[model samples]
Target: MLKTAFAPMALLAFVAALPAAARDVLVRDQAGFAAAAASLEPGDTIVLADGEWRDFAIKLVGEGTATSPITLTAQHPGKVILTGRSSLAVGGTHLVVSNLVFRNGFASGDEVIATRVGKRWSENLRLTGIMIDSFSNPDRRFEDHWVALYGRNIRVDHSHFEGKANAGAMLVVVREGKMPLDNRVTLDHNYFGHRPVLGSNGGETIRIGTSTESMSDSHSIVEDNVFERCDGEVEIVSVKSGGNVIRRNLFLASQGSVVLRHGNGNLVERNVFLGQGLPHTGGVRVINERQIVRDNYMEGLGGVDFTSAITVMNGVPNSPINRYLPVRGAVIERNTIIDAARITLGAGASDERSQAPQSTRFADNLIVNRDGKSPFRAEASLAGIAFVGNVASADPKVEGVVVERREVKLERAANGLLYPVGATAGAPRDLQPIAREATGVAWYPKPAGTRVAFGSGATVEVATGPALAAAVANARDGDVIQLRPAQYLLAEPLVVRRTLTLRGHSATLRFSAPTLFQLEDGASLQLRDLKLSGSAAPRQPGNAVIRASAKPMLVNYTVDIEDCAFAEMAGAPGFDVIATVPATLAETIRIVDTRIADVSGAVLAGHSEKGKEGFYNAERVVFDGLDMARVATIADLFRGGTDESTYGPQFTMTDSSIADSGAVLLSGVQETTITGNRFVRSGGIRVTHSVGSPHTEIAHNSFTATPAPVIEELHYTGPARALLADNRVSQ
Candidate 1:
């Protein structure tokens, strides 16, 4: 949850000592915000109002003392939403921004949020509880990033980020042309979800330094974060620069590995990778020299080639940023790998230009192959690589080495010694468990509700009948309405204009008309544990289950449907779930743990029939743990637009199953990520006119009796680059 209250009185006393003019200012509009920012000083606080602000650029450019930094915060945490082509730049020293949400926006600049405005860099800056969702504009032909860090001693923590669809990383720590300065940044306790492939290279969750600055030493730290389905082509966390530390992070169902792509002297330790039987779930890949990989646990990794559990790559003598450099003095020690396909040494050794790893040591490591498969494979000769006291067994009789099914328990020691036998081998005590049960937004706890804001409107229970309309009409913000088990037939479209939740207990809602639900501007709706059924007759040309308009200048509308069932109805030419009209602003749509069976049209559609310049583009749309079966066409599952004038959509589908479906098509969009999904006799994915030619990622999926060509590229004249790795297809 976001922290809305100020700090203790003791801290406020220090701020009170500042100049009288340097006081707290409450700003409600853009003009007031501009005036406040221009006159900000030390110990000043700018509190934004709890509403939506559109197309505002916040360039915080003032220096503050170490003891009294300037702060920009929301009046009510998570309530101040900024949308519609917004940008933020934080420069100068000792500055902070917290609890502000930026969504449904595109960047006219190079980045959506940046530390350096132009030539100035930030120092001692901290960003907390800020959320950046789906900040990309597909109409811009060039590349754009979400967050760019070009400062020293920066800390970004306790934040949430979803749907970075354009090119570049979610967060980038840049090194300015080998200036002998360590960035010393730290990113922790954040949640990064579903970053799609950026067609070409350089699509990472967190990247330090670029090819030109690859030799620079960043010395950054990335820890305690959850990266779920971050299949951004290659290098989930790319440590291009040297002396970076990546530890205690949870990588769940990601296709790429943490790669030391450039530079040397990096440390990757105590990271936990839970593949959960997904293909191409890699652990670590070592590229440059003098890197240490220790005390990590990797389980259920099924990737071959360079994406193996632990891969040591052959380096080019004078390699560029894109190519690998030789590995020297890499120590792989005290780690446990369970059910991984291969632990490769000297990957790409056949390329004579790439030299083999020198002085690399693999010691005190335990590899448990439960299926009696070989865990170690050497692509080239291990000439200078040292292999000392490594154990490979189907059943290792060591304490704390419990193996059940495909998972292994190596947290405790049985005989007071770690497996694989070395002097420095022991269990690590610093590793923390990451929450896997809560996938996306559930990772963040919801605020406790007040007593008066309970049940429908006033803790009232409405039985199954025409009373739902009355209950909805009487509902207030944050009201919960409970429905009993019965069928509700709505004669007209039910329009919701408040923040409310409709929960069902074995209840079914059937629409007699074409449209079922319509969300007005500034409305937020959540439907949980209900069954939504469409009309029995075929859907007309413009009918939809749910319809919402885009009002960018208004509030950021949200619709969350979870643990529900969408029963199969008659065939329809329109969408089955939701559709937005053209020229609408950005909105959020999330469908979790739902089942949709026997649907005729696209599951979700976003388009403008009139071809308006500013069409309705989704800020972020996520589909998790969905079981979709017998759909007519999966093509344009969640479309952005029909042509080039429309901006792309940011879409992510994880842990879902699609069986007997048609082709999935993405055109004129930014990104479409498909990870850890099962396809049974379904059509493949087609990409055309996407901003990044292959910004779509189809990774770690299982295909049984699917089409011959799993991924098709159409009309993309550039280098067709999509990351298709670790897919298990049984033709």
Candidate 2:
């Protein structure tokens, strides 16, 4: 009886010694927050007051139990705004960060939210109800990430990350050391919105592992997310690690694919691609081994090749870890593909990537092609591939599988999707896609961007150099700065940031500046009826009349030079009439009714960006109705260097006249058509006709008294599939 009494007394003493119940501490500044956080116990809450918190480096490091987690939240959800070099560093176990907004700002360092600080890391942490909107660097070339996840058992849910107009993936799961990653992180119910075309390779939405961790297993899960118009690069969710599962996500009108890029043993299942016939919207691409793609529903995707509705890629023979690995045991089964552009097999075969997919099974899918387009286009051989139990609108007698095709009629499902009527479960009859409204926070508004029509804003007229410079600096978002018909000798270069038209009525703007006008990211410059010339003493600078950018940058709006004339550009050897620096990309460069004469350099030049994997600066280049003479090289527009991505470097130079110029180098581009153009004593067209760019045509062009070799074919591999016909050449 005495022993029982002593035990009860000891238990009572221990319970009395425990700290008081958890409390909520309100902090107004970073120092107060840090002080409150240091003394926090389990279940303690630190609430930040509602205000504009600028340049706050928050370090919420603590240790808490699973049942009573430490929380850092706002007084009101999304009322505590952080801007200008604000970052959140989270460490320790069971820590929760919720209900804050990081907007109109960029990270002071590389990451906005990093789970690991030095050697300390967070495990079993939850980051929920956060908004990172327009949190991008001023320089789009500089790379940064919103959330860089490390450690294990992390959950990022119900968040809104929008308007990432810079380099780097929005979120990345990284692992330290050389060991394989086993993070088990879950990314769910998030909205990745408004990621414009980054025009580079570092524009993925969520990248699980990287080329360094390609051979490792992450075991991560990305599900129930909505990717809204995230047209960054060719790969949206690049799965570079093994054993990760991506399921039930809605890729809504995005321009890239969910690529199994590097590692193997990944599963992509039940995702719905609601493309709605959007151009360049893609589904899934299969690479590596043991990847399973099953029970997915994709429709109205307009991308082809690597960005196809379903692309099974050809791999490199004996590839390294960073390069393309051969696709083995890729099981693609029971998917519904309707009204999509192309379901390609053996896609992206080149000089190095020549190994066909071995032991792959593509079975039990339903393909409905109503556009009368051939639903298939193959570059690699169909050996060792199996296509079985699939119902297609076209003929089912394709190479690979010997299984007979199924005869089924198409019927509209209740969810507005077309399904195989009277089909079983294996025919994808029960795949229920999620609604977009259920994912993100209802209060946080979705981003809306409208292409400001040219000359739609206030019309400001400027005559002098200072007036023109001031007008450009103070113009509205979509203003038209009409340069009065006079010679505006500008002393400094002008950088444009908004969508504007610089209309000059027979005006001449002569300058010695390296770049007369610089177009930054998200800026559009439309030069209408301007006579541009440069006659100052040459300073050996690679000057451009209207340079796009000198450094690497992200996507710019447009550069339309209509009815413009370039008299001369007297500068260094690398001078160009209108130039784009390396890795600086523009959406379109349409020079219509343009005339170039007495130019010492190329009309268009940006070919310095060259290396391994084919990434040029521009997406499309059009030189229509151009009259050119005395120019060095009439137009040397290098689009795709050696890219295997499906997005094209479309080039169309139709009805142009060139004389006494350099060679027109256009071999590395795709979607090319050079017809009805006249060349006189100048360099002929030099192009490579490979299997990768088979849809090329150089036809119906007259060459009078030209050189002996009018068309130089620099074939890389295989015979030329390009149509070089109906040319009249007189030597």
Candidate 3:
């Protein structure tokens, strides 16, 4: 095999019939090269001397079989440069062109192409170790597809392409004519860089598509390529093509990345992506079916939260209709995402037709968010999403964060079984009288009777997981509560409104009703080492097993909950769990070291009402090491209204894990910082209602399975004051 870094050894070996004679026919000038190339014979060699060859139009007029192909080589490798008034067209098959430079070629007004017309249809074409440059300047108006290819058995390797100053698309492959051939193209080890000086009208680095309709392709590969500062994008568009691969490519300062339309059985893996101006349409757009995207890096430039990191749609918008359509079915696995404050999966808008169903499977990934929650959405009917063995955490508060107590109870149980006695199981009955205090009052722990019992002297309740409700029902003010480890079933969310503490361990707390826990009416409470969950059955209603509903003017009321786990057990409802509350005025809350799993919508912090709805100003909230797995509504928080008037930013989550399902929802507040967390197998993140210079800092996090916009600053309303840095992001 006559192997060259640019030429495929397979193609070289196939042309075995070519004579091995080193006949170097030298052409010192353009005219000699033109005449010689026009009459070139098979097994012949055309060598150009080490000098400038200008105004030459070399077209293949002879045929070359796989066994006897012609060779065009530079006499001194890259010393020979060709400048032509028109493209150099090669219509013959099994050709080898290597180690030469093609620059300043005059392109037709219809197409700014420097190579042969892909429509000429040649198979087994090898373009290796060549440098093609277009220095046409920025003012030139070129056509869409540069370097258009339309044949099978194509090999483009070890090449360098630069569009010095032009507004054009690069490396386009499409079906040109009726006798279109299935392309088996190999694009590898290439360098694509656009002129950064041009600025405004730069071009995408690579594009693969069809001309009239979807073109069927058997095998195509794009690997080990480096693209930098190219206004162009790297994309795949197919109406009927199947089986392609894009792997191990480095992209920086590109417009966007995508896999759209009818291409099936495609694989995108091991690619590194960076930069911005992400089309404003999102990242990794997929409208095709049966595609596998894995082990890639997708990072953004500065702080621009456009959309999810990976967007898979069943169809495209109605307008600008193309030949290809969208469908369902995809596999997204093991890709690292960093610093994207928005959701990772995009299924179009809520009202679009051909919307993507939640059918994509996700597994074995690591996701992180810096200053905001992850934006990853999982719709209904999407099944078999395995999210196992992942960690989600964030940084600690340096400016001294406020801790609050929302729900507390005092009761007793035995041997992992509920006493089935009292109604408010572990809630201290004696404390009920003092539970309701005036608004804007802070309640600190007292060293009195029952309050100073177990677990940091927080409170000891005599209730197991099963008897938790009975214990709460019998709880009184200033009562100590001790609980055992096991399933303690409850009919309603335990509401704590007194200065009390509830402690439990080695026990499970089950809820038979909605809103597993609620803290309202000026209550200050603390909870530790407890497991709260919804009914352990399926098809439940819309309600969070643990909810905190407080009034707008309520102040100094805190809920400090730590080291607890919440889950929607087997066959539980499809959605809504963890936390839910209607918007109230201002309050303080904190949740630490908690785990939520297998439910729809993990947390809905505040729900708003109509007309002058209560204000919600949460003072200090900490979501430390909160891991959410397979739970719906992992990130689905909504602002009060659509219009700008009714909004505020008052929540901050530090150190949390949202690994799958739903999207991150941010509502009204002054400032919110989401630092050091993981968001995997989920949708995007949404933030609204910013007050003052309501800043959101997303620093040092991982998003391991989906594409999303990293939210740095919101437009008009306020600045996100987003700071994104030093992170690992993969596509």
Candidate 4:
């Protein structure tokens, strides 16, 4: 019809030659502020003033509303200081910003926080009072994180995040699915400190989510914050979210708090966990489920030896709906803990009923196990779980006591002081008062109890073969050999010595061909629900599944390989060569939830003399959650040989999916923690340094169509100290 009437008169003559859509605009330097904020259109606002401009880079799109927004303010306040080095991106949406100071930025191996703007539900954005620092470099990779918020009604009020510690990822919030419409976001009165930017790619100060999408709910409101000397206060979640509100914050001298994976209704009220004397300190940690840790307060500190000030397992160990439960449906009311050498509660994924949690409720808590010398005590289990007033042991035991830790005394009927007698809390200094002395030393709770139940007493469900030969022939003296998920089919190789625990409930095993699953030579075994392989492995069984030697091995194993194919048999190579091996071993071998296809001579475990210790002193090994279709030729991924000894090869990775593999060699390993992994078209990642390797750490990992993203030390054999921080390499 005449091209729709001249296409609406050519869009009204291109909207009358555009350009009159203003709302406050101004910018200086750098191509006139990137051509006036890229020719703003959406309710514009670009006012930037205050001098000192350099090599700035920005990447923004369009969008604005919610009351005519689209700002980029600066002007009145020290004006502006977008220093050099490069990178800055402000994604689409109702963008708004205030007071600026985004200093000298630069990225070495696999650049991070180079202003890679946010995502998800584009909403009213605001980042007030900004300042993101980072200068000094020793090749430790300087971190420059100001914002990494992945969208959602954003608002980062009163901000300031100093830098230099490359375990980068300052303030990150992720959520891109599962409705609830993302909800109001706010990080009120902020300030996060910095210093050690790369001492092995430090831990997170505020990591937020891990992402696999789905499960939203979303709602955050962190009030009055201040976390100086911030040394890794993580929050690694995979999915599931809820309204979170952490009030009155102040976490000085941190090195604690890790709530990895899965979450629900949240509220960590009135926070304050100051710890100076570090040694593995902790205050809050809960793996999964509906949470509401009320009235928080954990003073001083006391270095833990095992784990948990708070913990709930199963990020993956047999992930029974993420380790059991709807969890009472979830709730851990009124909290006021102190000291805590180790105060684990409802572990084994909230007290295993096969990982059941459907209505977990633990009222008015006040755990002060410090006096009782909590080396690690506190295990809840009122059957399914539900305990009203908790106060662990200031004393009241002896009556089938399920899970209790009670102490309440709140006389604040309008300022009456006295808040501890079992304080149900109404706020009396939030009942934090306890610091009289405790700057370290504390460890009691070794009645030989940490309850790792799997099978025992009157034939526990099923473990087969006379309860797996009486749980490894009456294992004692630190016992732990639990296995029960079924399917074990070996003709040989099932030898374990001393301190055993071969547990399994959903376990599956098969070895039709060249079988061999040894951990002999005084085996210090600890295997969990497993699944082995074998596809003509009488000739394809060199690294079929496992074959360990050495003694001090403490493996928290996880292997799953369906149709079978790990390596070594016909061409001879199914697990070979290994003499000593043990330079700095602590063990945590994991191949992970699998569905792997064709594989040969490259699963793990190597060492003859080079490195002196077999399994290259496996302090940590992880092949990672798999679904590979191919992993042909083999090099260093499972190697540590080439002699000349001196140590190398420590590994760790999450959510793996390596294709046509090869390179992943740690030319002498020492500290490696590659996170949220996803490397396609592999064959890249080589770090060198032997003769007692130094350090190597890579983070957040995400490399698509990889050919090369990071390959440090092409030759240099020692003193390289590699650390490629916060990666996200594109094709």
Candidate 5:
């Protein structure tokens, strides 16, 4: 540490004003670095020796001139590794840090890297060419920020941050103190990759500021970043401060929107959302005031609610900073939106958020939607909104958007994007195409592994041993392994790594091992007409018969179970009949016309920890046309213990019969429906914590005697909506 003998301000000026002769100091280890750190002067460059430097708490603190800044870099770029609980703290003026990689670990504390240490602040710092890849904590509940920026004039560019499986944002330009000051920060040319569904609020890739400082100005610029498969939450880039410019970012196949959640005077333009018709892929969502969204292009997105392309949300009256504030003076224009699911105006209009958006202008935009949904959807009143010069190609019959409905043909360009054939239909003036090769470090490639192209295969039948394993091993993407009509006893777990089906027609698969079927990343399972059971002593490891990938995956898992029977199954203390590993999720788990009986644990375990925001193992679960009985619980889908999460499990169970079991019903889901079912001698249904909307329905069901309909006994909050009627209760 540099000792200050003179007055603090005068000493800072005296040190910052002096420019030392430039020198290069080579240090092999932390001990060697510490010996030279205390005497660091302006224009000094400290070069760390490459190769595994594990668990090093590096602190660089000193003043440097703007013209001659101090730098800390690696002897060899892309070779210096900071693994196993390492952190960096830089507290001073005019410093440049570059070319260090963080891998296979997390921070020792709440932050992996902080620009300030305690009350000491940093100014005019630049960090570039850094990579934090798959750097995660084991405990998903433990939230840690990767980068926390403080003070003024900081820039983090040409970096790659990927696979943050745990909670917390990847980068946050922090604004502290009771009266926070303006901090000018820039985050550009970064690559954010493959963030899984965190199922809660702490999953933003970049958050400029928080709610307490939402009214303050950060003056941050986040542009030219590439976010690929970043399905962390509804808000990928959560802008929570004022006077920020978010432009020219490319979101490729991601499932979240850039939301202006708070603050005012933000400009969002020229961003391209190329989703390829993936579900839950969104464009931009607008809230609060003085936000302009223009010159953006979106195509092949399928999301609703807050993930809608341009969601002008409903607001709470006189809301606080953290809550949903009223939308005022929002301008959305000059954009080309094609093949998106919906563009919502006044979305999420509930009794809680009764105030609609005010003084909004939607003008001169071209929308082409071909996914059978209307291009524009207005859930709230459009009294204060002005719609002008907008053109729609599909379903232009929607109200409040009185634009021309015409044929706007599209052609697939060389860049794989759909462009208008030739038109002046109020689209953007120019297509600002961002190059795919212009973001992130040149050394670090995309975090997503090689995309495997599986060949078409014929259906193979097998009984057991390497024959069955070989059949599965030789299977391709759409292949089916037809099981023989006999007991296929599995000794070891069969891990499925491809998209295939297990055709078990009147066949029984007995799980002697911990897991009968394990799914790695990008795996999908279709099990039909099968009987799944366990041995005399059931195996452990989540007490699950099947498990998903242990780590966060780029493409989420999808499992479809139909006409399947489960009985005589027992597992570890906390087991699910169908379960996934922590921090990993199955996008859709649809169980239809199935029967489950004699399970010791819940029929399904939602492996989310308590007291965490937006943590879930599955995105959407459907239990339709099934018969479940004699289980601990039919479906225990509970993202329990918090009102902070906005992501929902989105549960739906209709036309089913659940007997002699308990049911949790719903918890922390965005939308739920428990309709058209027969409950016999069960604990009944309970609904808790309706996150964003209160659209829960428990309607049109029949309950046997001894368990009266108890919708409000477990939770009396306003989550349970109307239509809890039309139920037949037998006395």
Candidate 6:
């Protein structure tokens, strides 16, 4: 959200007082657009109409004042879709382009949009409220980029980018020559989604400066953006130049991490990496000298080798642009890493030719390992690195390196500097709020909430396993099956088909195997005051404790779980406590007053099934007063898929607390309200790929001991409508 304070009436009066040559103009097609571009003046607006303009190219060469920029915008945001080999070459100074959509298009040249048209570089350019969706070539080879900027003081904000396929990066900042100053670019409040892995390298989502210009200073800022499934072989946002800042961004299920591949004196801070147990998913990969990586939270990272949570690679001194340089004076501090398999200190240690990173500092870092294995894996000796005040599950004996052996415990506090152990860590900042009139569109409708009334019916008391099984099988609607204070071992899943209540009075259900108590369509289950544990050890992939699948027929299903606990349940690495379902059916799941500990999977995971077209939709869901700790990953705490028709999930969570968890990926979802929740040392909440404007409300949430920007909304094209407000976030 980007807000600009401008009085329309005052602006009208000021414009009316100006000469007619300074007025705005409407351009409906390529001819009019060219005419406007040829005679573009300061304080002028060139309006592109709403239609499919195919194979059009625009070379905007204009000179606007610092106070007045030449504007090129659509008649309506997301309405003027540009298709088929369109290109925009911006040159000159003080230009503004907004509210244009470029989709179903292929590049006619190396880039669809370029700031440097020929040898001239644009200056003080701003692109806002723009959307580029599924803009790719026919071969899916990234031969061109969506945006190739070669300019100074450039700002790209509040834009939506989706489905970038092929061989090149989605966005690139090129440096043609050494300038007097760095290219000061700001990329904020943008959404980058679904860029698949290019078989080889060179497919970064955002590449700032190239290897040839790696040493040149590019003081760019990339913030408040969402990177979802942008797994373009490693290095999602490759920093090749020096003195850039990447902060307060959400990287959700993206295969790679932010890499300072060739730069020095760069800052990577307050970013959230929600890997969700995906292969090759990682955190920040460090190289070069005087770089700072701090206050980032990484969870469910499964990558090994250089793709670990934080990999400090050995550098070759005075190396070429493509080769790593000796990493000196690097500081890695105040980061929380949970359920990551590897946190390598010396990534290139095995290669003797690669020089060891020297004078690096690692401090105030917390690594919580649920598995029995050690979190720190060093390939080289730690003699040259400075390791201090780092907390892990156990002593990470790195030969000569000594780390403080203390249990990392994270709790919610009013004012905490760093995220406690087991809390979401990352950039906890929100985008600047944009005024509604700035976007020229209305927000999407907010979903209504549905509250179900539960009945207290007859009670069936059970003392033994057989009695409990029989009672569950014979239970009627609104009947309560109460279990006595005992441990019951079940060999199979208890399939509940009718409406009933399963209450526990100091009772525990230990499953012989990984099984789920499933609830079918038209069935409702209420579980209260029970403990569920699995006898199996935590292994590869685990199973869910509760499962619900929607049938093809549209029906309503409900599951209300309260005051319960889940422990020692070994789920598949990426599985969840609640399994995936379909979108055709209306379902309501409410988990309140519960404590989930030592769980190896997510609390609730939703996804569109493979070969399935629709999403796993829920009419309304709520999570209240939940204490979720020591969990492996909350992958998409409300997960959705890539299918466009799959509607977003409407859900809310209030008065809940989560620590040591993965991200709550609200991509492709709508109408989410997360209020009064306490997130300590956990992954951030990211909303992206949304269907409507102002689709979610996140208010009054206390984010203590966390990074900046607790909540982020990315790549939404609709009008801004008061979504995030009054959240207490500590940096």
The model with the greatest TM-score is: 2
Per-candidate clashes, comma-separated: 9, 1, 135, 70, 2, 31
Better of 2 and 4 by lDDT: 2
TM-score order, best first, reads 2, 5, 1, 6, 3, 4
- Please write out the lDDT profile of model 3 over residues 607-669, one tens digit for every residue: 443223223334345667787777655543333322211113345666677775667666544
Name the regions of candidate 3 deviating beyond 4 angstroms.
Answer: 1-22, 65-68, 84-86, 104-119, 137-140, 195-202, 233-240, 275-283, 299-308, 314-324, 350-354, 375-731
Error of 5 at 727 (Å): 8.6
Per-model root-mean-square deviation over C-alphas:
12.5, 4.0, 28.1, 23.2, 6.6, 19.3
Tell how far residue 503 is off in model 1, in angstroms: 29
> How well is each residue in 362-438 modelled by candidate 4, as lDDT tens digits?
56666554355433443434354466766654453423234354443433322212245544432235333222122
Q: How many backbone clashes does candidate 1 have?
A: 9
Worst 10 residues of 2 by lDDT: 707-716
Off by over 4 Å in 1: 1-21, 139-142, 178-180, 197-199, 320-322, 394-430, 436-731
- So what's the TM-score on candidate 6? 0.57
> Which residue runs does candidate 6 get wrong by more than 4 Å?
1-20, 178-181, 350-352, 411-731
Predicted structure 2, TM vs. truth? 0.87
Model 5, 630-729: lDDT tens digits are 7777776766544533556878889999888886556666667889999888877776653555457778998885365554323434344545778887
Considering TM-score, which of the candidate structures 1 and 6 is the better prediction for this target?
1
Prediction 4 TM-score vs. true: 0.31
Residue 512, model 3: lDDT of 61
- Per-residue lDDT tens digits for candidate 1, residues 1-731, read 12435456657899888575667889999889889889778889999999988898888887887878999999988888889978889998899988888887777578888998678889999998888876766532236778888889999988877766555678988788633359899998888877644333445788888767777688999988888877655578888888999988888778778988887899998888877676557889998879999988887887655668998887777776656778899999878787798777777563343587888887777777768776566655577687676666654332322222223334334422223333233225445556543322333442222112223454457885579988877778778888888888887777777777888986999876777777775467888899988755345665667777533223346778899998655456654577765434334679999988777766676544223222334656788999888875553633332222122355777898999876565555556787898989888666554332224687898888885334444444434457777888886
Candidate 5 backbone collisions, by pair: 199-614, 200-614
Query: TM-score of every model?
Result: 0.58, 0.87, 0.47, 0.31, 0.83, 0.57
Cα displacement (Å) at residue 721, model 5: 4.1
| Displacement of the residue 292 alpha carbon in candidate 4, Å | 24
Total clashing pairs in model 6: 31
Question: What is the Å distance of residue 654 in model 4 from its true position?
Answer: 27
